[model samples]
Target: MEARSRCRLPCSYYMTCKCCMKRMDGKGKSFIRRTLGSTGFVQAVGTKAGPNGTTLVSTGLSDLDKIIGGGIPLGGIIMIMEDIEAPHHLLLLRYFLAQGVVHGQPLLFASPLTSPKSFLGTLPGLTKGKDSKGNVDLQKSGQSADGLRIAWQYQRYLNEQKALETRRQRQQEIASQSWASGRLHASSLSPNLSSSVTSGSLEYTGTFDLRKSMDQAMLNAVNTVCFSLQGETDMAPLHGQCAAFVTTHSRSVQEVPNVGRIAMQSIYAPQSMHLFSEWKMLSFLAWLKGIIRTANVVGLVTFPASLLKPSVLVRLQHLADILLSVEAVSDDHKEMEAMLTDYQDISGLLHVHKLASINTQVPSFPEASTYSIKVSRRKEVVLEHLHLAPVDVYGKGSGNAGAAQVLCSTPANAPSSLDF
Candidate 1:
């Protein structure tokens, strides 16, 4: 039979052809393997390597990654766009936790955005413990359900045990190898290690103590902590409470006190929190800067994209290492095109392992490893906007256009450049 005709036949014909081909080729497994090669096997069995180094995986949005370097670093921040604290943002948080669990790293997620329940609900391959009556179990489901929390708790124990075992093994290997006049064996034992395994993840935790007050030591432990609140308020409240938060606390950061330890307050008011005057907003940010001294704590404050004035935002941009802007995915043609372009660039930088962009139409970002979707159910558009010129967006040239600044200049927030 012709090749095309044979291929067109049912299971019986394919099986007979396969056996005959294998017999003729002297192949053991199957004729398909011999014909297709290694690349075919790779495609069939989808196993890809995890990210190397401290790579920041973006949320497949270019503008988002521009400010925050793809997404946030593994043991770093994943800024949330707080809009009544939705489930999708919570899902993204769990994704971060999953990455931490698989790679054996601790994750620190501090948000006033949503309650912990919203976050617990979105974890990938994770669920809450069940009741006595056989409910959806969370703590112990004999699955990877509690992987994130378990990984965090047991990491120290594992590290200590591994270190002791490694030392003992090394000593034993040294003793076992007999010296031929001080010459070791040709095949010596060497432990297999990788760059990440050696460097290890940073362990900086944020523990809330109501009585102790916010201090330097506590601040040092927290790498990235976000303060999420409402935005778009009237003129009076903005100046009143917000102004008080700045004048009272922010002013304190500037003064030098001869005491036990300096108190550092974290104040985050996202634009979504509520509407406030430009002056009030600037004062709040200035207060945040005052609290961030020679400390490791990465302070994050969220605000609405709509309310921010360019002049005030440009000034605020200098206070953060990474700036993240969040927008709801839009259906407008021009906006969609912009979003697609941003998504493609971010996917390239973040190097997401698996990505799907689902919605009205999938913009062809062929080179991306991540997925993009155009779904109607309110998707968050996150961008760091790494290549965007801050000057063009918020600098003097642009006369305060309605276009919001997602992230601002990094140099503005540098410790040396900061004005205390």
Candidate 2:
């Protein structure tokens, strides 16, 4: 009988094939390596690295990262579409910048329209423990409400919970190191929605007050990559310049070895829109997308969907890997409350047009989520799924109504006394 041999791949050149890996030349090998390289310089921006090897990076909003796939992949672009009246999107931008600074990652903030400093000021001061708005004061220290002399049962329960939390946080610290030390994959959140680590996910290192001058070292680091540009029409050339600058920083042993994080903020603002013609804007983004995929770079851009025509925004949406739109909840608090009656609290609907690179291996990635950006004290900045009870009662209120009826069923009493 004749000896037979078979090759399974459609094409031997298909990357990742064992035979291909063996035969691959220097460039091919490098391509494969880069494809698998971890964006570990930054940690817990919300997403894990993909198997394809493109570096996964954080937006500096761990909450946002969790909602939008594993976090934005390096070489990926996020088009944050904000409302005309609402500036909540700016909060996310500040988080991104602050996150970069904290991680000591090289960041490029190019804003043709807004005052970079004023916008940067919006970043909230980093704190140790932040819970639901009302509960923050309670959980100020590691052991919240410590001053209160509570009963043993409740205290013991708290002790058990605290112990569990401590163990989880320890796990998070270990996991965070994986991403920081150039390991690509990470569990974005510990068992809880929030990260358990010390610094914690998306936590800013320090506060920035306009009254006080910025730190010398922090200022210098930001200055190295931040570009305050003029003459908006053609920024494609400037794109090349920025990429080169980032490359230089990443290679320099003197600077922190960080992955490049670029924030092309408000590119559609009036200051720069005229500079980029319809096709010119598209061309620039296309070039940008290519750069991020090949290099250790991830970009975040804000475009006012209101300013540009829908068609133009659609074109941009196509170019970007993820597109998020924010709308104001309502001017009237009562109106907002009435509108989102089912939810305990909701800021606005976070319409996510596209979400890619979901890590299915991780069970946290929900099959169906009513994604929203809630109005909370701490976790309010990014898009979060409106956390609801698994068994939604839908306002039936039978138990409460019965209790009320029992008390109120007595006939109307005189003003002096009513039935209890």
Candidate 3:
């Protein structure tokens, strides 16, 4: 084990740096505020402009990346919605992970729902297939490949085998930890040994350790996506009563002031459950905020909006800055609230934040396409309640009429944050 350095912290406290890492300024006072505020700082400095291939675009979630820049932050939380079985969330995650792999950035998925073989194998960039000799090779099957993807089956097999072996060894260690205590008799450990032996025989092909695997993968080209359901039982749906019931049942598992290092969430809904409520949007939003800050991961939550009111839909829109309403394309839009809004003008530019019908159809990309709505900071609107501007839909070019490119109209006397 590496030796930890000792630091003279604020309040004359001498703490070891190993367990409780401290960030101190030149004067030696605690920089807790600064460190906590750094998240916002890192977000403001967006990813650098480069070749289009270098950037990882997301499916429509305008304000999401604002908290962590254009791409997911290191060790950040990511949610995927599986309610409609659209796999949109998984596809987007795979795209980001593929980009990360190409760029040497690691990714981690903390849930067991996603299968690396079948789910991730579909991605063009990261998916590795094989040749006749069972050697690693690239799939040049189509123009979408663009000479970037490893689409061979044998190569994928090799990678899967390697991952399996690694996971098996790690699991063995964890499973055998009881041996260290010497508290259990051989007979008592029989069941445990049997389970371990059986598990090892299964040939762990994918990264099985959701938490640890994700942590380590984030340091490299590995991208992990965790699978978790978002609602309750089918009969009752996740209504207020159900939420309250679950909350009561889960009170013991949840802890306040969670550790910053771990991506654990206080609230979770299994796939077998259903949610029902008019204020469902508000509850979901509050829960999402808690999950985001607590889990420290990006997530994609899915819920039915058919029974919700227009006010609830609007609240949900605000709650989730980046909304991907599958209903729009799934023929459920008839019952759901309107997603498109009237176009507005900003500083002589046409700002299309609320679109009535930009297009009901999904956009196409060469491989897989992900839409990113980069939302700016909240700005006050005149002659009406203040409204936040959405991302710059158009490319960031001069004279672009997108919300991002155009500057907000300033009052003659009111000072602006930019002025300072």
**Top lDDT hit:** 2
Candidate 1, 1-420: lDDT as tens digits: 333332332332222232223333344444344443322111000011112222233222333333332333321222333233223333334434433322222223433343432342333331111122222352146235545445777767856865765564344333222211111112111122111111111111111111222222222322222222333244444334333333332323423211111111112344333444556656655554444322112223443333455665566555543443333333443323332444333321221221212111333232322233222222323323234323433435432222222222223356742222
Cα lDDT for residue 62, candidate 3: 21
Candidate 1 has a TM-score of: 0.30
Residue lDDT tens for model 3, 1-420: 111222222221111111122232123334344433333211100122111212212211222232223433221233332334333334334434433333222233322233333444444321122121222233223324533565565566656766775564454444333322221232233334233222211111111211112222322223233323233332233334323323332323433211111111112233232243434435655664454433323333444344345675556545542343321123332211121121232111111122111112432211111222211221211111123334345644343323221234333355753331
Per-residue CA lDDT of model 2 for 1-420, tens digit only, reads 010111133331132222332323233344345534342322223323344444456676656766764567666788888787887677677767766654455667777644555545445434434324324554675344464666656877877877776565454444344433332223221222222233343322222222333333443444335555556446755777776854553433323334567887777777666766777777777877766655556788887788998898888888877777776665454423333443445556565666654233333333323356654554345456444333335964333433233213233353532343
Cα-based TM-score, every candidate: 0.30, 0.60, 0.29
**Top-down lDDT ranking:** 2, 1, 3
Lowest-sum lDDT 10-residue window in model 2? 1-10
lDDT of 3: 0.29
Candidate 2 deviant stretches above 4 angstroms:
1-48, 114-118, 128-219, 222-224, 229-233, 249-257, 333-337, 342-347, 358-370, 378-383, 387-420
Instruction: Give the root-mean-square deviation of each candidate in angstroms.
Output: 22.9, 14.7, 17.9
With candidate 1 superimposed using the best TM-score fit, by how many Å does residue 80's alpha carbon deviate from the native?
A: 7.5
Using TM-score as the measure, which candidate wins?
2
lDDT of 1: 0.31
lDDT of each: 0.31, 0.53, 0.29
